[model samples]
Structures are given as C-alpha cells and as structure tokens.
Target chain A: MSFEKVEHALHKRRKSRNIGLGAVLIGFVALVFVLTIAKVVDEGDAQRAEQALRINPPKASE
Target chain B: MSDASLNTTTQDGDAGFGDFFALLKPRVMSLVVFTALVGLLAAPVPVNPIVAFASILFIAVGGGASGALNMWWDADIDRIMKRTQSRPIPAGRLSEGDALGLGATLSVFAVVMLFLASNIVAAGLLAFTIFFYVVIYTMWLKRWTPQNIVIGGAAGAFPPMIGWAVATGGISIESVLMFTIVFMWTPPHFWALALFMKSDYRDAGVPMLTVTHGRTSTRKHILVYTLLLAPIAIGTAFTSIGGPVYLAAAVVLNALFIKGAITIWRRDETQAEADGYRTEKRFFALSLVYLFAHFLAILAEAGLGQFGLGGWA
Candidate 1:
C-alpha cells in the first residue's frame, strides 16, 4: 500500500477504537445509575432493620 | 547561539525531578493513601495521632516506590504501548538506572520509617507489599500469565491491612475484609481498561485479558468478577468497620458496577467499537469512584462513631 493509504488505515483503526471505548463509557454511566437505585432500596432495608433492633432487642437467656 | 546552547537544550529534554515523580504514579499513590488511611482510622485500637500520620505517609511512600520500580522494569514494553509511551522512562526523559536507584532508596526509606512509626508486623507487611509489587508482580507475573492482575491485586490490597496493623499491632477480620474488597475489585476494574486498550497491551506483548483471551471473554470475566465483588463489598457492612454509610455506598456502587459489566458483556464488538469504547472507559472511571467511595464511607462511619452516633458501634 502507498504511505498515504497506510496512514489512512491507521487513522481509521484509531477512530474505531475510540468509538468502542465510548460505548463502554455510556454503559458505565447506566450501571452507576442502576447501582444508585439499588443503594436507595438497601438503605430502606437498613433503616427498617435499625428500627427493629432498637424496638426489640434480642432476648437474653441468663 | 553556540554548541553550548544546543547541549543545554538537549539536557533540558532529559527528565528531571518532575518526570521521575510522574513515574511514581501519583494518582495510584493517592488511592493507596486514601484506603490505607481508612484502614488505620477504622481500627479499634487508638494510635497516637503523630504515629498514625507517619505510618500512613510511609505506606504512601512505599506505594510510590513500588510504582517507580514497576516503571523501571516495564520501561521496555512501556515504550511500545501508546497509553504508556509518554511515561518518563519510556519517553526517554528519565534513565532506567535512575528509576531503579530512586525506587530502591524510597523502598528502604518507607519500610524503615514505617518500622519506627509503627510495629514490626506493619513494617513487615509494607516491605512485603513493595517486594510483591516489584519482584513478584512486575518481574514475574506481569509477563508470565494472563492472571497477572488477579494474583497481583493482592499487593495493592496489602496497604489497608498494613495500615490496620499499624494501629492495632495485628491483623483482624475487619482488616481482611477491607483487603478482600480491593482484591476482588481489581480484576473487573483493570479488565475494563484492558478491553479498550487491547491494542496497546498487544503491541507491548503484555498478556492482558482482552489481548490473550479475546474481548468477549474479557467482558465475561469482568462481569463475573464484578458479580463476586458485590457481595464482598456489601458483606463488609456486617463487620466492625462497616456501618450504614459504608453499606449504603457498597450497595449503590456494586449495583452500578455489575450493571456496567453486563452492558459491556451484551454489546457486540462493532457496536462497542462504534461507540469509541464508551462503556469500557466508563467502567474504568467508575471503578476509581467505586474504590474511593467505599473508603470514604468507612471514614465517615469512623467519624460518626467518634461523635457517638454510629450504629456499627
């Protein structure tokens, strides 16, 4: 291949690679969103558990 | 205007203190410092403030030393990798010999200073962390196996445990859990970067997951490791160091981490390539926040406990 053609091919490959990386970045943002939702849900459970523990301490067998 | 001017310009092109410092990988060092500080703060034993500061400083120095040594050894391959091409040694700004000398000096200084500031066990762990990163991980595993990051992750995990030892004078389940969180987190985190930087690793002849096993397999491994990391991270909440703050962070971060992995797994190479590896880059960035958030949560819990308001206590 000519020098210009080789350079063009390399540039194309780099561009494609950059695009691939961008897709991954979008996916990561979506994942972060999902996890944030999950944490909100879990926080509710933690609060409930705290309330339960406070209201009814474990029975003792002295 | 003369030959002397030319010589001066050539000398200026060579690396000085700033270049050598970059080789120490300050960003990685910061993460090490943050996690180690969390470990120290979360320990049940009360350490003197001065000693605690000194010990953590030594640990950070130890981490930097490890980075420098890694750069020294990996300079050859680094020159071939585009992502690492501008690094000090690889860019011809700093000599490999200088890196070795600096790394060796810092290694001794960090370890000996840690010994003075803390107990023998903490100091020993710091020494071993440096050895593992430099000799075992960098020298042997990085070139020899695809599981390099998996096994080598232990070196990064040791800082927190060492920090814990610095305060408590021994290891505990809590410290081990902190160690496990980072250890489990490393593979998925690094694999995401590997997926996008596949060509660089291939060019450098480094057997990263994407280069050796292929991108599909690398994505699957990332998903698998992230799945494993979720439980380990959440489970920390049941430990002494865990509280509402950490539990909240873990639950949120792990969910996001897993979702990210799954998205990456689902995408075809063409689609991902079209998107400029967006998912991959996001995963790598999130991985950074994941670790920092977890440690920050631990620190928050410790602070709350000090104020007599923590549920974990």
Candidate 2:
C-alpha cells in the first residue's frame, strides 16, 4: 500500500471490534441503574433488620 | 533501530480492537480491582452488592484510564525501551491523540459513575488518583526525578482507600493502613526491577532510581524500604481486616522478603550479571507474589471476621 493509504488504514483499522465496546458501555449503564435500585432495597432491608433486632434484643452474651 | 529484518507497515500503524484494550493496561487494572474489592469487603460497614460491584468497576476503569493516559504521554520513551516498546501507542497501533482521548473519557466516566454508585468521596479519590498518575507521574515526575515512583506510588495506593470510602463513605485507620501497605511496598518493588532493567530506563531517558543513583544506591534503598515495609505488613495483623491468618502469612512473607532484600543488598553488579541477575529477578518475581499474598491474607481475615473468629484483641 502507499504511505498515505497506510496512514489512513492505520486509523481505520484500530476499532473494528467496537461492537464489544458498545456492549460493554451498555452493560456499564445498566449496572449503574441496577446499583441505584440495589441501594434502595438494601436500605429497606437494613431498616427492617434494625427494627427486628431492637424488638428481639438479639445480642450475643460476652 | 539496528535489526534490519523486521518490517511490517514499517513499525508505523494498523491494529484492531485488542490494541485499544491493550492501551488500558488490563493487568494493572486487575490489581487495582482486586485490592479495591478486598478493601470494600473488609470494611466494617456493609455496601449494597450492586453498588459494591459498580464501585469496583468504576475504580478499575479509572485505573485503566490512568494507564492509557500514561501510555500516551510515555509513548516516546516507551519506543526507546525494550520492556515497553510494544504498548499500543509506542507500537503505533493507536495514535497518541486517540489514547489521550480515550483516557480522558474513561477518567471522567469512571469518576462520575463512582459518585453515582457510591459516594462523592470515593469518586473524588478516583479522580485524584487518575490525575496524579497521568499528570504528576507520567507527564512530569517520571522524566524529571529519580524518586518519581515513590511519590507517584500514591496513585496506585489510592484504590483500597477508595474502596474503603465506597463502603464506609469515609476513610479511617484501616483504610489508611491498606493505602500505606501498597505505598511502602512500591519503592522496593520497583527498585528491584530497576536493578535488573536499568538499561531500559537509561536508554529511554526516564530517570528511574537505578539510572540516577546507580545500582548500589538502589539496592540500599530497596533494603531500607523492605525494612520499613515489614513492621507495617506485620502490624496490619492487629487491624480490623487482619487476624491470625494474616499475621502468620505476613510473618512468613516478610521474613522471606527481608532475606531476599539482604541478598540483593550484598550482591555486586558483576556477581548479579554473572548469574544473569537471578537474585534480582527472583526478588522481583517474589515481590509480586508478596504483595498479592498480603492482600489475599487480608481477604482471608475478612472472611474469618465475618464468622466472628477474626481480629486481635
């Protein structure tokens, strides 16, 4: 190939498998949304568990 | 530039998806992820599982961003160095501008995502780590000073602390100790490699410890840093993330590390070269294992802590 053609090819050839990169970016976005929900759910669970512990006084004796 | 036979695209350009990914330095990113995971898991507070996952992922991304930017900036020196000549930027698979763009994008993305997933503190620390690595270390200190790795080591040391912040939403002694462990470990670990690979830094004009101070000074520094590292390594056993399992592991590891350092300190370059730098090479390899084992032991202690059977009184 000619020199200029090779230079053009160099840049063009770099990202052929960008499908996988796209998928990963999508996955990252999905994970962020999932984590927001998980935090809410986990907080709710913690509150319920705290209430239960208070009522039951579930402490181990030293 | 002397070897006549190797000519493909004239070492100029052309690469695929793998080249871009290679620019991220996945190996270093994995270490960042592992240490950050241990820090998160070992924290006293519980994090939402998905949040924890996201936080670690962002931290990895941030670390990768640092690597990419470093590669972009260091491409010139990298091309001259045998050890680093094949990196994406240096190998001409990716342009320096492309690396800089990707790294900047990832740095912002990771930090913002971390803030969304965890807390501002974690995200802030991640941003700082990335900046310190790319700007302070790669762009500035690396060429200017021999002690580049010492202060620059803070960038690598921040992940666990960032992980701690992800879980607890704050820093504490435990997280600080984790940060310090990696920080103290960096000088000796890198200088050991410097002992054997001084030629690379010399040729690259990168001002590594060996290039500036000579092998003898580097050796002494390694032994001194190892001595400084031992107490910290063993002392972590009494911390929240440590237990008998950790103490035992650390004791054995540190003893062997000290032995290795002493041997390296005692050896002259002639002796080292005569044996093909075997002692230095062995020490360098062991340093990797040593750091990983320490982190793994901390993780083990965390598992035991979960069972109410860990930590010293």
Candidate 3:
C-alpha cells in the first residue's frame, strides 16, 4: 500500500476508537445520573408515605 | 493533485470525538461538576433528584462551553505555551472555527435548558458564568492584565453559587461564602503554577503574576492570598453547613496550606531550582487537594446534619 493509503487508514481507525470511547463515557454518566435521581425519588416517596399514616388514622367500624 | 492531496486536505476533518471533547477541557469540567454537586447537596432546600441531575448536567455543559470558548480565543497563546501546545486547536487536531461553533452552541443549549429545569435565577447565573469566562476573563482580562487570574478567578468561583441558586432559587450568605472560598483560593493556586511555569507565560505574552510582577512579588502575593483564604474556608463551618467535623478539617488543611504558602514565600529561585521546582510543584498539587477537601468537608458536614450527627450543637 502507498503512504497516502496507510495514513488515511490509520486516521479512520483512530476516529473509530475515539467514537467508541466517547460512547462509553456518555453512557456511563447517563446511567449513574439516572440511578441517582431514582434513588432520590424512591426515598422521598417512602418518607412522605410514612408521614401520611402518622398524620391521619382510619375510623374503627361500629 | 493526486489522491494524496485529497487526503491531506481532509486532515483537519480527521479529528474525532475526542478532539471535540478536548475542546471542552474535560478535567476542568469534572472539577466544575464536583464542586457544583457539593453545593447542591449542601443547600438548605430539598431538590428533586431529576431536577438536581438536570441542573448539574446543564451547569457542567455551561462550564464545558466556557472551556471551549477559552481554548478558541486562547489558541494563539496556547500555541506558544508548552503546557498547552498539544490542545486540539494548537495541535491542528481541529479548526478554531469548529471550537467556536461548538462553544456557542453548547452555551445557548445549557442556559436555555437550565432555565426550563431549574429557575431563572440558576439559569441567569449560568449565563453570566459563560459570559464572564468567555468575554470577560478569556477575551479581555487574560491578555490585558497581570492580575488576570486574580479577577478572572471569579469565573471558576461562580459554580457553587449557581448550584446553590438552583436549589434555593436565590443567592444567600452561604452561597457567597462558598464563592469566596474558591475566589480566595484561586490566586495562591495559580500563582504557584506560574512560579514554576513563568517562562511559558513570558513567552506567550500572557502577563501572569510571575510574568508581570516577578517571582518575588508573586511569592508574596501567594502567601497573602493563602492567609486570606484560610479564614473564609474555616468560617464556612459556622454557617448552615458548618460543624465540628468540617471545622476540624478546615483547621488542619488551612494550617498545612498556610505552611506551604509560607514555604513558597521564603524560598528563592536558587532554592527552588536547586530542587528542580519540587516545592512549587508540591504546592500546586496540594492546592488541588486543599480546595477539593474543603468542599468535601462541607459535604460531610451536611451529611452529618442529615442524621443529627454533625454541625454546631
């Protein structure tokens, strides 16, 4: 292969490597961020539920 | 014009995702994200997880946009400086036009999205931060003043305040204190680097403290700023985020930081060079830990308060 052909091939390979790495990074960040928000929502809902039962009681049947 | 010419013409386009990301200055972006996260968590109000996540994400984007624009404008000086010469623009990995376009696009996206997710106050702060870093610090102060890092440090210092505003919907004394911690810390941190890398600034004609005021003056300035930073950092403990744990950490860290600054102040170029700038480099590295630990301490305090185990009794 000629020098030009080799150089072009290397550049293409490098671009592919970069794209792979970028995908992994963005994916990891998004996953962690979503998990954090889920944890917050779950905890907040539990806390509110506990408070609701404490603040109000059901009437007993005659 | 053969096939070789076509390949050569497309060389700049050969830049990949990494090149564009490098334009964002990921390392700096990470620091911005971490500090902003701490600020959000430490606030007095409760923030929804999704809201907090979106706010931090947009803030990080705004921070990254600032970095891109900084690289765009500083491409000239960056080409001259050894420490920054390999950045995408200077290394010919990407074109300056591409960097500017990326910065501008991200800046608008971040600000507009932050407003939708958070509030006008948080979004306004983010917008100002982008404008300050890009227009004020990078374009104007960087090339014009020897005190560039001193005043320009405000750009980095705004993150925590923006983070605070995201939750609180306004500014407060606590947020201002956080801002001051970073602001006061900036000079000593950067002056240490400038001490060792004076030649870079001199060659680039950037007028850093070491370049304009000379090393003697820079050393003195570092000590002065360190002294100022200690009280503000320690004083943070007495506020809503303050507690024994943070106070203890602050005392110890500031003592060490102050001692390091004094060491930098007392030594001459001969002593510094004799040891291969080991002292200056140590101070520079320590400055990073110093800032990181202070913010961490604040988080610890907030964490403790969550369970009735921390802060002023």
Cα lDDT tens digits, model 2, B14-97, are 467777789889999999999999999999998777788888988999999999999888888889999998887777667988
Question: After superposition, which runs of candidate 3 have C-alpha atoms over 4 Å from their true positions?
Answer: A1-7, A10-62, B1-10
User: For model 1, what is the error of residue B252's alpha carbon versus the real structure, in angstroms, after optimal superposition?
Assistant: 1.4
Q: How would you order the candidates by DockQ, starting with the best?
A: 2, 3, 1
Q: Chain A of candidate 2 scores what in TM-score?
A: 0.50
lDDT per residue for candidate 2 within A1-62, as digits (tens), equals: 64433333434453464665787879977876788689888779989999998999967989
Give the per-residue lDDT digits (tens) of candidate 1, residues B1-313.
Answer: 3334334332322444456668679989988988899999999887766567768878988999999999999989989999889898777767888789879999998898788667899999999999999999999999989999999999999989998999899999999999999999999989888888768888888888888888899989998999988998999888888888888888999889889989998987998889999989998999999998998898888888888866465
- Which model is ahead, 1 or 3, in terms of TM-score? 3
Docking class of 1: incorrect
True contacts kept of 3: 0.13
Model 3 lDDT, residue B267, Cα = 98
Candidate 1 residues A33-53, lDDT tens each?
A: 654565466569889999999
Q: After superposition, how far is residue A45 of candidate 2 from its true place, in Å?
A: 4.5
| Native contact fraction, candidates in order | 0.00, 0.61, 0.13
Q: Is the docking of candidate 3 incorrect, acceptable, medium or high quality?
A: incorrect
